[model samples]
Target: MRVVIAGGHGQIALRLERLLAARGDQAVGIIRKVEQAADLRDSSAEPVVLDLETAEPAAVAEVLEGADAAVFAAGAGPGSGSARKDTVDRGAAALFAEAAQRAGVRRHVQVSGMGLDRADDPGMDEVFSAYLKAKAAAEDDLRARDLDWTILRPGRLTDEPGTGQVHLADSVDYGTISRDDVAAVLVALLDEPRTVHHTLELVEGHTPIDEALKRI
Candidate 1:
């Protein structure tokens, strides 16, 4: 399968690229900086420079052409403010989905957060809350699209070695999943169309990642 990932330079995105490449699948990384192409090359994935914040839907669709699937994995990052969170996490993600619709790509996946449920509480003015809200909006946009979509909402991400074990639930459940394991789950979902039109909450668990994915 050919996969295109937005915010290709992100850690989890890179890990996903490597996994796809190792499996002899085509992985395309959509980056903002042309210079970052070198970073993606080392992972054996083609890199297409694209600034989601500025790129029009047609321009984004051009990069998505001929791709089998697209993953919305971009974020404004820690140094960014609430406005950027909305712009990149929410607006950019919506733009990507629109572009995918225009390009006729039917399969899409979005990486979201776990705490977006109560993100709008008056007392929850924290940056993390804002981030969750942005993710929630992104998920909503993807869900509204006329395409097969899956939203993976993982809890606190850790850099720890992947255990290849995860808890996959149809509803919000767990609160911690490794980036590597998340990548593994995404790849598994790509192989199973049954997982389409589903939203899953993931966290590191005792079950094998592949086995847990089967339960979904």
Candidate 2:
């Protein structure tokens, strides 16, 4: 399978690329900076320099051509203001989903946050409200598109080494999950089409990651 990943420079994105390559699947990373291409060479991924924030849908779809699946993993990290959060997180994701449809790619996946209930949470919203809102919007947009989509909403991300065990369910806990574990789940979902059209929340758990994904 050929997978095209948006925001390929992210730590989690790179991990996913490595996992895909290890499985003999092709991974193309869409990066914003030309220099970022060099980083992907060591990870066995081809980097396509493209900015999701400003690129047109047609241009984005061109990069997605011949891809078996497209994963929306781009986001504006810390130091980005609220405006950029909407533009990159929500707008870019939405555009990517639409472009994937235009390119006739049926398989799509999005990396979202766990606390995206769309309810009014006073304390947490104030701290990461923009991020939550953007994730919610992106999920909703993907759900409305014409594709076999799976949205994986992960808990607070930790940089700790992957435990290879996780909780996958409809209702989520706000526990921390490793980026490596999330990448493992993403690759698992690609092979299991039954996970399509389902939005699952993921976090570290007692069961093994492969077993948890099989149950999904």
Q: How many residue pairs clash in each candidate?
A: 0, 0
Report, for every candidate in turn, its global Cα lDDT versus the true structure.
0.89, 0.89
lDDT (10s digit) by residue, model 2, range 89-178:
999999899889989989999998876764467666453688778888899899998899999988889889998889998776679899
In model 1, the Cα lDDT at residue 201 comes to: 87
Task: Assess the local accuracy of residue 88 in candidate 1 as a C-alpha lDDT between 0 and 100.
Answer: 97
Which pairs of residues clash in candidate 2, taking residues 3 or more apart in a chain or in different chains? Answer: none
RMSD of each: 1.3, 1.4
**For candidate 1, what is the lDDT?**
0.89
Stretches of candidate 2 above 4 Å error? Answer: 123-127
Clashing pairs in 1: none
lDDT of 2: 0.89
Model 1: ten consecutive residues of lowest lDDT: 169-178
